[model samples]
Target: MADTEVQFMDPLASHSVVPSGQQKQVRGEREPDRTESLQNTGQGEVEELLLSSSAVVAQAPPCGDRAACSCLGARWMERSLESMELQLQLLTSKADDLHNWVASGQDHFEREALAEAVSRFLYNCQPYFNHLEYLRSHKSQHTLLPLDSYTWLVDFSQQLCDRLEQLVLTYASYNLLCLDETKPNSVSPFCMGQSQLGPLRVAAFRYFKPMPYLAQVHTGLYKRMRWNVARLREEQREEGKNERVGDTEYYFLCYEDIPNADAGGDGNAVRTWSIGKWVQVTPGTDDIYDWIMCEVPQADYRRLLFLGSDEPSSSSATVRLQQMLSSHQTAE
Candidate 1:
């Protein structure tokens, strides 16, 4: 204590006099880093949380009440059915108009108009037919609809099919329609003729094998023609035997190419064959002929064959035809 001047040191003074950089380092040490804290929380946990949220959202229904959702669905279906019914009614009216027009024996121009209208009707009806077919294939959906509604839809579709088929045949009977292979789907009169020639011939050929003929000088020349004529004659004779008037008739349109036969044999020659009678042949060019098979056969076997072959066998339309036939049978 001799001459010390009573000097006193504070311990906290040294701690408070730290450099700015050192102060920052000391504070950083005391506080945890945000990045490090997040790192400590595992990525798996974050992903699990996101997944759980998504699951909750997915599990939630469109409506809070189950019955409410069902009611909404039923209402939508009812509206769809109503709209479909309207379409059916409109188409039926058009079909009736077409029937009247055909019965009137209108001129060529009128026939052309009717043919275009028919093509359009068939094209338009395809969507509805497809929808009905969908309902038919899916039992659950079909059952969900009201019984009366489903029945009515099926019945209307069948009736529409019958009407359209008849109209096409009636139009073809005029022999005014010609085939233009280039435009199969065109609404023109030429393409409309396809509705009669294409499906019916394909169905008939597939169902009934070509009949055999005796060997002749021009065997290969008229092979198809001979077979077609023979089959048609046989079918017509069978129908006549039962004393039932046949609904279908076959007409051959040909152009002869003989070196010296009746001066080129009327390029647009058309001949209608009678029951059990063979078509007259000039023996010029047998393959240069087109057949117009008019009116659908009324027999069940023939009808089913025609329906099944209305489209390509592998097509959805064929399936629809089968379903329609099945439904028709059930109804009957």
Candidate 2:
């Protein structure tokens, strides 16, 4: 499995978080205040709200035998096989829309306009994240897409982001001992890394939505701890030498809910991803001036994040995402 071919996927595209066991941790400290959400609005609550079942109650025992674990996993895979096909169909339809939108007219003109179009399309699509009215409180939908699935998608992101933020606060409390806690403990500094990274979480399952398509994305955060360009490259390079790479090495969970293909290409086969959130497929995704001038509600994504390396500019990143997504559609 270590030598399994890596599919071309967007780190920002919607995806699965790393598995619970294999996840790598960034900090070993503790922070309580940040964990309030996890205490109140935790995975158990979220699962109950969505699955109408408690993950604790539903969780299977760690089988005594690997063959047994594999057997159970295989059964789960068989059940999801059909859902995966449905997800594939939805992807094709969305890709078709993108192609037509581009080919329809030169009139959509600005990247801003295209971004708006993408937003409109998503709203109509019923993206996830609808709030439950079981309690007396529920906030109105804010910056994320207005679609139902997109809403859940945002909720998914929000929950994970909140989890990570809490982790940061918690870890900040620790002197950096490397927390290795029980299930409830989660990896510190960023629990999302432990809870939401990896393709086993990412590529292995298909998303499902009962309202629209039979299946959608099955799979698929956070500030602070910024690293400078030269420093980051050097750090990452050093980590590589030691056979260590990105923490949690979990880029799949944050995959933008777009096609697996992006705008640029190294000519490898493209892999379609699950539903994504806040896609940066168009330029000006980070254009502060354009957003201000257009009167778009500033997303808390309001702050600019400069993740560009010498290899690609932020705009190129978006374009490359588009190209890769397009290529994936073609390949499919």
Candidate 3:
């Protein structure tokens, strides 16, 4: 969706050419030269290969509708998704280890060591291009995270990208496009004036994983994109049950800017968005980051995105969101 274009190389362009001198010709009998015959055969083979590859590429539709995609494309997608699943398992294991360590009442030195281990894992687990591409295409599918556990990996990696600052713009642009695509009655703000942010931005903002608890989220529900609302609150309740034991359901607020109807103008304007709290909130800590509270209508979700300008802090966003929730409960 980003204006950036990717040029793909022809799969058969680098086919090996057999040397002309490698083929020998018989001395007599008026038979066709062996070398010529071999060359002709090779040329025909190359043409066939090229034609096959081109046909696959030409016929392949967007991955969103994988059921109708070419067999070759579907195979690649399956491979990519399988690889991602393996990688996700590794990440989840690492996060669980970290949580267990915290729960064990380790000393300060031990805690530091675990933190360092997490840093190493995060760096090593950075997704490959194929994995990222699959994620890009499979954004709307609920099949990826069937159980909705350990989705914080995406958020954690996204937060790391924000701190690194490299490739931020590229990610941002992609995220903007994805956000629009997922939104209901979505508007194309990037075309009107929004700048592109690349993959990191896209991952941090647009990517949605299912909540770890029961009950479906209403916003963007038609697209089958789940947020962490139900499970986040569930985690909050669980946190209260066991104070000392370290569990993974820590919560933090995150805010993103999205397109909204302009009050007095024809053009789209940015709106602040605070979904449910981000995962991995520190134990025994209250109100660590800034946030605000608000209710997002399912019908308007297409216009909503995860990245934008002039957003409020987590605390501010949390407060606003709380107010909205309370008011909505009262109205109901």
Residue-level lDDT tens digits of model 2 in 167-271: 333322332222322223323222111110111111111111111110122321321121111112354444433222332211111222233355455444432
lDDT agreement of model 2 with the native: 0.27
Tens digits of per-residue lDDT for model 3, 80-164: 4454444444445445544555456665444434433333332233322213432433432333332222233233334333332
Clashes of each: 0, 56, 36
Q: Where's the lowest-lDDT run of ten residues in candidate 3? A: 192-201
Worst lDDT run of 10 residues, candidate 2, spans 130-139
lDDT of 1 by residue, 1-332 (tens): 00001111121122113222111111123224532322222223323332333333233224445567555545655555555556566667666766677678876555555555454444444444544433333323333445565555456565666565566666656653322212333221111111111112111111111112222233211111110211123554444322222233232111222343454755543322111212333332223341123111111101122221112222223333334434644776
What is the TM-score (0 to 1) of candidate 2?
A: 0.23
lDDT-sorted candidate list, best first: 1, 3, 2
Candidate 3 stretches with Cα past 4 Å from truth are 1-69, 128-130, 133-332
lDDT of each: 0.35, 0.27, 0.32
Score every model by TM-score: 0.36, 0.23, 0.28
Which portions of model 2 show Cα errors greater than 4 Å? 1-47, 53-152, 176-326, 329-332
TM-score-superior candidate, 2 or 3: 3
As a whole number from 0 to 100, the lDDT of residue 228 in candidate 3 is 19
Estimate the TM-score for candidate 3: 0.28
